[model samples]
Target chain A: MTTTERRLRTAFEDAARTIEPGSLAPLTIPSRRRRGTWTVPVAVAAALAMVLVGATLIGDRMRGGPPPAQALAAGGPQHILAVRAGRAVVEDVTGHRLFEVPRAEGRYRAVAGTAREFFLAVQTTEDTYSFYRVTLGADGAPSRPRKLPGPLFRTQTGFGKPENLAASPDGSKLAVVGTVDGHAQVDVIDVRTGAHRIWRTPEGGAITSATWSQDNRTLGFLWGPKAADLRLLDTRGDGAELEDARVLRGSSIRSRAPGFGLINVFVFNPDGRTLTAQVQGTKTGDHDDTGYVLLPLSASTGEPAGRPVRLPSDSFFVKTDTTGRHLLQIIDGRPGRVEDGRFSWISRAADYDDAAW
Target chain B: MTLFREHQLSLTRTALMIVGDRATAEDVVQDAFAETHRRIGRLTDHDRMLPYVRAAVVNRCRTVLRRRALALRVGRVHEPPVWSAESAAMLGEDRREVFLALRRLPRRQREALVLRYYLDVDDAEIAEVMGISRSTVRSTIARALAALGRQLGENA
Candidate 1:
């Protein structure tokens, strides 16, 4: 080899020697064998029965006020999973706690769920966090908490204390936001394979919240403390590549002056074509008196697509259920269902920190 | 499994050169190993295992670089890979400068340089591993060497 080439190889080898081998967990080949074929028929029968019962209960719910407790005993999608008083509680539409975690960890910070499972983010240490995946049983009771891979360090995005983790609609991936080398990043983990992809915010700001699109290809996250705007990152690449990120600044949503407001909470609508955001802004001239408005935004452009729906009360957060049919607003620490352009009281104002359906 | 056990460390070192971070490099190697294991039954030629594993590792490294680039474009702060004090001391200033500058090169150029110089693969092998044409590999390596020379203040 030429002298210069020899030096380059030598330098690389020298650096390579410094890295300790087996620094990552050993790979375990997943078992491909299927187990328990007999249970399938019985499980299928039970699921069909539950669906019939759920449809009946939902029919009753649409007719009038909250359905009786017996109707909610079936434990369907109508129930809200919330973090209240350091506990993970599953409350019915009427705000009655149906199931609660037996041994609650540190206060539950944020939660997201699909039809089959609930993913909870809990603050375990002063600076570290943990995750729990709870599978829902037929009776609507959550099974024993199965801790997911975490002890992930936390990074505050100034958007409030909501744990910045979200699950995809299909529940195949969990996007958890954490700090790496002092920079905030979102790590999208494939739950089945344990394969993960990390996407660090280009601006280095803490991501306040993140939600995946219905297709799971687009990720919408709140970026700012400086240029507080909703940004959409296209995660469509060959397992390892990501398309260029698109910043959605609905022209109407930008503050007359820079840094006048922040898009606090955002979630893609069920249709995946648009989104809803809770915007907190100061009056143009008066920097004092802040107002919160629920604004509909174009999912493609991040611009205000419809008229701003002013919130009646000072709600701290907003979320949509997996079905995208129910919108829950947290006002005075209590969750109320929003329908027909109005907020209807569902659960009494309590010390609930986060909620998901 | 035996192939993995025998050459895992060497494969990891190769990945580390391309990725710059130990943890990420290890993950890349582990995934590549897992992938190689899954496809092991399809390999009719035993001699081709090492080449297959190398290509897998290199491709995984590219995936990581793509993610980093996406994050940077969206205004997310990227923390450059950290090097241990011992490694830094061993590398010294000139080697460290070269290493840092190497990472700054475009992904294709970086891979070409590492494969040619560190792995000591010929242009034909590099083209096969990189999934590019032989002429493309030649041009890429030439351009990479020119860039390196400019960064290092020496004819590479």
Candidate 2:
């Protein structure tokens, strides 16, 4: 063998020795998965199920609850923080530029926060990110950007430099998905104390579309390569491992239906019981006619709970305002509003990559 | 099941070389064994079971690397078994450097080298596990050795 081959063999042996066989846990065989045999029962209950669903819809209408199609457009916030061409600006609901957050080092990449308070992150270096908070005055003028106190984050590489940043509905906590030593990590930071609780991934996978629930403690995110399903992480839990987050298998539209295709973007409705997602394909597998639709999925089971709202065009961004009724959607680079089950263009095409109300 | 029990540790160690961590490696192996057991009724040839499980483990490892998202939740912090500074300390600088260099290789090249050198499997077995021809296995291992040497600043 050559000297290089000898060196490699020795190195491999040394590395293998690090794991002792005695340390391995006993094999825990997985239990057999029982197949469902409920087809006959399901068929028998189909008519009754439809009647019950119709009654529930009528009850919801009588209670004056927002229609599922227009639930996210109920009362939208007026001011928004958006990142456009490396600049962070506060804008009105109509896409009119209101006030620009003062520029510092690095390019602004992400904007997430709610109400009068918002947070943005700047990619200071490749893989490094820093957070800043911008609070809007009553008149909608943005305050000077305040740098958040914390260690700079080593975010995953690529265009979305902030990885995924979501501030709690109350703006009291911030959850940032980043990387530490090449492994994915989620760090939840307390806005008041600047303290951090980190959850580390045991393996590698891209985590995106971070959305906070109404409780301000449950974090919902899309874990991907396939964008399979949305996963939930409890921020208040003491666990420091990402596995502490439960995989909501039902939250995945693709698994819910074979032809659903990929879920491009999703957010938790204010009630935290439904996920509003922009999903591709249709149940009939008619890919040519139907492109994409705004879908509301059960947060727990990923089943479609409401009729899909058709978009004017393909949309990659969707953000719900504090009321959970107001939705701001970006389609083909233009901002629009999804209200009363209809989409109306609200502004000319903008260069913004991300925005939040 | 007996074949899996006999080779579980070695297979996991092989998977660790591909996946860069022990938890995922073990998970990959366990899933592969469970799958093999699930399909045992379909297998009439007993001799092929070991090779089938090895290929399954390797394929599952590839899936884990591709999905790249670790969704498992634990109650405490999970210190990754490799690449971290603390793991580097445990692995020693020489082996750490080698592992790091191995990680930089393409997935196929890295797998080829691991199966050959780490598992000390012959070219035929490497081909069987990797689903490539014996000649391709030899060529891949050769290219991997040269590439690894270049990264390690050594003469191949």
Model 1, residue B141: distance off in Å is 54
Query: Which pairs in model 1 have colliding backbones?
Result: A201-B76, A202-B75, A202-B76, A203-B75, A203-B76, A204-B76, A204-B77, A250-A302, A250-A303
- Candidate 1 lDDT, tens digit per residue, A1-357? 322345577778777777766654666665555667888999999999999999988888789646332322232356778876567888877778889865546667678887678887777776566677887665558788777764454543211233357788888888765445545566787766556777664343334457888997777765543343466776655333222446676222563322244565678887888888776564222111246577777887776776666665445366776555567776645667765455567755455666777
For candidate 1, the share of real interface contacts preserved is 0.16
Candidate 2 wrong stretches, greater than 4 Å:
A1-75, A158-163, A178-180, A224-227, A250-259, A282-290, B1-156
CAPRI tier for the interface of model 1: incorrect
DockQ of 1: 0.07
Q: Where does the lowest 10-residue lDDT sum fall in candidate 2 chain B?
A: B69-78
Top DockQ model: 2
Candidate 2 accuracy as lDDT: 0.70
lDDT tens digits by residue: candidate 2, A216-321:
8899875532223467888878778776778776333553433555565678898878988876553221111235678888888777777677776446567887
Q: In terms of TM-score, which candidate is strongest?
A: 2
Chain A TM per candidate, in order of listing: 0.67, 0.71
Per-model TM values vs. the true structure:
0.49, 0.52
Candidate 1 residue B104 C-alpha distance from true site, Å: 41
